[model samples]
Target: MFFHQDASFEQLSIHRVGNKAQDEFYVLSEQPVPFADDEVLPGLLMQYFMSPFAKVNEVYRFMHPNEDLELNEVYHFTKKFFDGKMDFHSLSEQLAKHLYEVSSHPKIKGGELYVVHLKNVQMEGDSQEAIGIFKSENKETYLKVYPEQGGFQLDYEPEAININKLDKGCIIIKNEEEEGYQVLVVDQTNKSQEAIYWKDEFLKIKIRNDEFNQTGNYLKVVKNFVNEKLEESFEMEKADKIDLLNRSMNYFKEKETFDQEEFEEEVLGNPQAISLFKDYKSNFEDDFDAKFEASFDIADKAVKKMESAYKTVLKLDKNFHIYIHGKREYLEKGYDEEKGRNYYKLYFENES
Candidate 1:
């Protein structure tokens, strides 16, 4: 449902229970006798955690409220998400739907309530920074992030959403176009939240000097070229790999910018790129085992070519910077030990 820009907590309280900033208990006894103790509801869990939830591990405790809950539910839910059947978008929708189902239950009446802040907002720690929207229901609670001024009337009043330090309740909402997502810690009492982070299909690369007419086309070409090289179907000239890279760079300069939509169509329409991309994607494996293989292969080749290219093609200094894309575990935050490098690193020229 579309929320009003100025809707108050009182107006939305019917969908939830509990008062703002106060401990509101949801008595499972209100429901049927055999009601299961589903650990704690996600909405309440967020209040306890007080910090925004990032991933499953960060909020996994909610899957099983009590030891009595079957272990099978947790395992199956986790498998469904990690097994590649669901992505973030689909997961979020699923979570919302699940929450709606429970919220709509007869026993759940007026369970969702919020503590609204009019002007001044305060939290225990100074680091909490009453920053953005925070939300939760029965399944999970998370922070809602939006682009700068993308949506949400931040000027009026912002709420503190740090789940790590939350002692009291606070109403958080972003009433604007293109804004409305929640960050909450979920209690996986039986079902786990959906895993949907693997949906990013493209890794964007900036084209310096605005040389390429269609910005995305350069990416498409590079993507296609990479796939072809990976599958070993298309062979590069006998010349050094750096030479091939230089050729691609030069080709990018020659192509003029065209409409993004048209460029996408053209790139996708190309039978060679299409076939190569499909092959590359089909061959790609997101599991831990496949990630190591793919990343290692790319890194080994990219590093070698970079070393040669730094001295010859983009010649300037020995130091070269490089970036790579991989799964979160493959590429750690700040530093990636698996690759023995940081997310972005500087290599010195001619330095061993």
Candidate 2:
């Protein structure tokens, strides 16, 4: 199938390889994609299809929660989608109609959702056409989103609010020539902002995708390396390990790059410890078949994204995440007589 939009809806915009245009998106198939997990697959109302873009490059787009669906749910959603009663476009309209009903935010005058089930889309590169789908909510006007609390809410010349930056959107790219697709999702509503009730409107489901649940594999491995290997190898205590991890982060922040010797000195603060680190780094990488960076450059974006993983935690049986950071003096570990439990007491001053 090709080139479909409601005849009444003239607002459907297409970005493709035209003579005058540099950016382009082409829909190769009018058919719904059969998707998979680990392999890509689509969810209900949200079908899974592959787009050619996934092969050419990996872009960091905020994915929807459901984009990374497991096999069963994927089949369920796709089955509901392709049940043969409603076509892709009809399903899209049904979704759009529901969203319009629930958007009661006085300022957010609602908007239209453009759901085009596409396969094989391409950009300017030499890569072949890819299969995927697009479901984007387009607004007639920008919603007044920002609040007066942050700063002077001054009237300035308006620029087109980036849809992906502010509202809900999703793009799924089919994997290579295969039927599976990778997804990119975006949901930009602020915490304090009044709800648009997209869920109440249609598709009562929370999105779950690998993109949103990214463990930052490399950095995660680094963290595990510290926790599993180095923590035990050096006979370091939990506090020591936490401190070392904190110091390593700072070293990277100040130096902007990680060097083994400096990390040893600043974090371990002893020659013997440094030697142990060196040995472990070498052996661990060799065993894992991964290259240990002599100097690992820390990107600002990565630091921002991965900062929370580095925090020290005292897990208390689902009660709280007692986050501890800073010098050890502020924390006191002791035994509780009545409770028959060991406890970590944190001392702090309320400067405010």
Candidate 3:
């Protein structure tokens, strides 16, 4: 996990970036932002920038398709700043200009951009310096209530930033310079055409192929094969599907490493089903540009994060919702001729 418990701001600069499509421009700050020697304001700003990254597990590295990393603007400027070849204020201006250039989408909003240099950030039990780039596009109105002359007075601030909701942010860690510096990003506001500019057009980052991603991607492929591809080739009941899902989850939970042959033999007893699943997995890898290892260490964090999506519920018409956890043989599906409907017979040894 990423943590900033002991992190402190070394320097911070804020600039305004406008949408280029609307013929707007950007304004750069002349110098770094100054704060008091105390920790109150710095602590608040730290929470604003770093709180959203606490549970972030996916890591990305800046990349250029042409194999020249200098072509990536963010990577270039960030490397210069980290190497002390460029100043903090100048780096912030350059980053703001780059962001404004990519803000060509008509629907994108203009906002204040904050660039901060942080020190002593704890990332996976390692201390590293990081550059935090955050943009606040949305403002909230907050009302202030205070006692004045034994009476409460109310005042409202129209343009206030909510610390809890960060619009767009990324932290460039200084650990991996040769591999694009281990960047973590957050874009909570825009998700449409405008969102592409933040991570794709501007940052130019690609996912790092690590154990976490491998585990997550493989689990997603398995889920898609069960939900989409299995029905095309075989006639399987809902209980059978749920059982497959349960067995998949249990294998990942119980085993440290994954083996394709073992998984096929244990979870998928049918040889034809295993062959079909292998073909579907190959297509999935080709379409998504992902490679899955036949044997790799399973990440527990990925499994826990993806557990919610692996549904085990069996819905019957409009009345009953049976949650099938395991033991598919215990549940039987049959057609009731008298009622002209389908029914399930559940077998159990004890009742709760």
Best by lDDT: 3
Candidate 2 — which residues are off by over 4 angstroms?
1-218, 234-236, 317-320, 336-339
lDDT of candidates 1 onward, in order: 0.30, 0.44, 0.90
Question: Against the hidden reference, what TM-scores do the models get?
Answer: 0.24, 0.38, 0.95
Off by over 4 Å in 3: 36-38, 269-272
Clashes of each: 40, 29, 0
User: Worst lDDT window (10 residues) for model 3?
Assistant: 284-293
Q: lDDT value for candidate 2?
A: 0.44
Task: List, residue by residue over 1-352, the lDDT tens digit for candidate 1.
Answer: 1112222121111123332224333322221112125445434443443332232111011122233322323222323443467442333333223333333223321233222212122221111111122233343345555457666532322333333543212222211102111112232221323211101100001111111112323334354455346337555422233334444443334444333334334434446755665455445422211211111111222223333332223222357432321111232225678986644323334744
Please report how far candidate 2 places residue 166 from its true position, in Å: 24
Pairwise lDDT winner, candidates 1 and 2: 2
Better of 1 and 2 by TM-score: 2
lDDT per residue for candidate 3 within 183-258, as digits (tens), equals 9999997668778789889899987778898898888888888988898889988888888999999999999998
